[model samples]
Target: MELSPRGVNMKRAFIVPAIMVLFFSGCGKDKNEGGKTSPPQAKSESAAKSGGEKAQMPSRLQQAVKEGRISEEQARQIMARRAGGGDKPLVRLGTAARGEIRTHLVLNGTVEPERSVDVYARLSAYVQEVVREEGNRVREKDILARLDDTEIRISHQQAKIQLEQARLTLEEEKNNHQRNQELKENELISDMDFQASEARYRQSRLEFENKTENFKNLELQLNYTRIRAPVSGFVTQRLIEVGDRVTANQHVYTVEDFSPLLIRVFVPAADINKLQAGMNAEISSDTLPGRTFTGHIKLINPRIDVQSGTVKVTIEVNDSSLTLKPGMFVEVNIVTRSREDALVIPRTAVLYQRDQVLVFRFREGKAVAAPVSVGVTEDDRVEIVEGLEEGDTIIIQGAEMLKDGVEVSVLK
Candidate 1:
């Protein structure tokens, strides 16, 4: 083609523009990343609308969208929300229940021996009596069983006779000495003879004293033929049968002291001040299902546990009806302090976090953190001393997955 240089250049440039236009045309397209989603759908809708993401948006952005316009920060908030943002950072919640606030302690404890004594027979005798069987109830001085008193009584009688004989012999010696002294004064007997009589009489008196002691001891032994309960309680062990012979200090039966049964509990050192002697407790256990036993604090250990950081608290329960036995694993609820009109919330509403306590309250439709001073937490309710007003809306279910100021779908 016949061409001028300038016109040729112009034609080349026009062709290049046409090619560039064709090449760049697809670059601005709203591609379906997959036909299921629109890359521009989210962005384009956001340009004209408040907060364009259909799924989620932050509280500030949601507000702006309601007002028909949003700031750049609001738009950023929408993007962040779309990427899984929520109000109230990951926390836990429980019910904010209204009730009395009572200080309590959670402890691990064990049952112990309450002055258990293995009965021993102090006198040697054949068990001639069977008064109490195993697990039988006995009282102090109550005869548990008896031993053969025939031998004991005979020994006692013999000792008593000997004691009387010794006393009579000593008396006769004294009478003779008195008369002999009178004879010596009259020079009717030699001095050596008088002295000899007196010596003999003194020796007999000493022997008599020894015999008297032996007699009393023997009599006491005779009384031991009747086995008596040292203290009142149910009999646990009975080693002797009806005819079994028992020697001195031999095991016969076992008795337990159960005037008021003792219960031991451990409490945290931080809450030790709340615990006191004579505090009321409610005891329960899996073994004794559906049964709650009431008890009172009998002792509070003066020392704190260094290793476990707990204090030992003891409660005494009345098991006189024989229903509660020793060594049963139980749950003891110790009431240290209580308030009839204390501000309390749900224990679940307050997150039991490590090192501190946290609560998430819905403030003006946004979740905000509320640091709390936790008091008595009984069952599902807890005492909130700080950081919340009465009747505040606290998130119970969704607090664990929320961030501050994020949009929340309240559960009504």
Candidate 2:
């Protein structure tokens, strides 16, 4: 039956007062009975004791238990759940999908250029001008530095003059020889005189040839006084400055060709058979972070080093931008094997137990440690040969603490 607001308020006030009086009287009776009391009194005593215990509880929890909203055990369970969170373990998941995967044999090597040449002075002279310094790009026969060629130039000019004089004398001897031949043919001059003229002509010819060669040599020497690049590349080192004396065949500069950089690596003999020319490779440098370059195997030595038991492999990188420099430390990953449509998953998700390989497969909010046949294990990724299909979700991170059938909460 519905009651008016005024009647409801008046009834609540009377009931509250009666409840307080009954509680007080029950408490007083419990105190008076002391060790002995009737069944009803004993029940009142028990109620009073339980009420005191309930007062120590939180207000909301006391109200809930008193109103029969929740049992004591259920309340404790809720508080424990709130205190320690839920019992489900948190995990990161990844899907098994078909993708390209490759296995690499990693090796460390030093970056080298296609060619490196040491520019040397072909003639002894002092450096007169430094046209190109270190880090200067140059081409074949480009003048790098001009040596002091003043003395060589003067000598060359003198040789030229001598060569011209010799040529004139040779012409004169040739005419005399022709005249002598005619005279001998006509019997106008004696044989001895003709023979002597012929001899002189021959001597003049020899002298002319010798002078010609001497002039050519001087010209070559003059050209050598100018240091030039032997190949087209960058000047990586300059050992001479202006006014510095350099001897013939002395190293003056070092030039390197940066196009199609090369790297030589030594692989153990056991793995050498896996390598071949024209295989793809990945190149990276510690100095240039986050940058990757593509390359291919240029050469592979068939013979293995007896002492080191390793084979030398050459990697060629076509880095047109020249981002990688010679002598920089680099790492090379030779892709010896690959697959186009393989079941791939994170390598971290795989667990190795004894002779079996397992992965935590997430299904129905539970982790199932299932054994899988693993194929190629590459960097951070592994190829599953069997036991897992496409679109299957597996625990990637936080799988180390997982057991069979353990519930988990997948993190987004």
Candidate 3:
């Protein structure tokens, strides 16, 4: 414990050198084990050892370091910031370009037949035969049903007898009037009797005309006993059966023309001006999956619906195959406006935050939040009216998790 000053200096010098040697030796070991190997190199070595494959740079920092844009220490610090939730989230990217953007007005509607008619009985009769049933296709003037015509036949026969009897009486009266006229010219009969004969002839002629008209009406009733289709179509409803006594004007069948099915949609009044007759339309149904039907605007109602504030639009779709049925619900898409070569981006890329709409645009390896004014939207694309130019890449798929000035990796 009792040492001189020289002895103290000698002990201090030896201890300092020894400590410096130990520190250098530990630094050499650290360089060999971890410090000299970069994160990408270490990842590659680990990947090769585990699966014998090249490792991929997982972050923007590692990629920057590998590309010599940033030092290893900087990359480590960047990754630390990212892990601590101080950096922006990773997102998938897309490019803004010039493309077509269409504006569509979507409306819900019901499918119906383009033309429909209800067949009714023209005369009271008993249904004796049913020739057509529901879902049966028929042509114009095709017999659909038969009614009992026995009473009509009897009435027709009676009318014919009366007509014949009146004709005979008319002939007899004419002959008598002619004979009376001849006698009156020769003064063989009085002028009064001649006038009486002339009056009887006229009355008989009128009776004959009345009888003939009655006979013709009876004939028409006989024809009506056979109910016929007024137009070519499918029978949607059949109300008559055998032995059913139907009165005149009673509904017997309902025929619907399905060659071109009609879709009735109510569009908002604001969009009514853009719609016109013969505009192309697309229709889809929940009942039919993955199938879209093409159609055109058939008619646009001039009157607006007072209750709904919408205009009635009729679209006609070809259904020659009879795949679409009446009363089926469908979705209709009407193209209101379309622009070619408009600046556009994926609709999913547009983000609405508060009152401002923005998109995360990728520029210089970072996500740059840019405000955008949108116009028309078609399908999965939207028209960018302002704040973006062509060839600019924007984050689309993972933009919801991204913020401004975040490092991004473009996925191939």
Please report the candidate that would top lDDT against the real structure: 2
- Tens-digit lDDT string for candidate 3 (145-176): 99999999999999999999999999999999
Better of 1 and 2 by TM-score: 2
1-412: candidate 1 lDDT, tens digit per residue: 7999999999998899898898898565555657444556686666646544454665755665565443456465546544555542332233454567776665545555466877889877788878998788788889998889887788888998999899999999999999999999999999999999999899999999999999888788877888888988878888888878789989898888776777787888888887767778888777778988788888888999889998888888876575677777788877767888777876546676687778888766677777888776677677887777777778764465566566565542
The per-residue C-alpha lDDT of model 3 at residue 351 equals: 91
Record all residue pairs in model 2 with backbone atoms less than 3 Å apart, i.e. clashing: none
Give the range of the ten consecutive residues with the poorest summed lDDT in model 3.
48-57
- Which segments of candidate 3 are over 4 A away from where they belong? 1-89, 301-307, 353-357, 369-371, 400-405
* Model 2 lDDT tens row, 67-173: 66456765555444444557776667889999999878999999988998988889888899999988998999999999999999999999999999999999999
Clashing residue pairs, backbone N/CA/C < 3 A, model 3: none
Instruction: Give model 1's TM-score versus the native structure.
Output: 0.63
TM-score of 2: 0.73
- TM-score to true structure, per model: 0.63, 0.73, 0.71
What is the Å distance of residue 114 in model 1 from its true position?
Answer: 2.8
List per-prediction Cα lDDT, in the order shown. 0.75, 0.87, 0.86
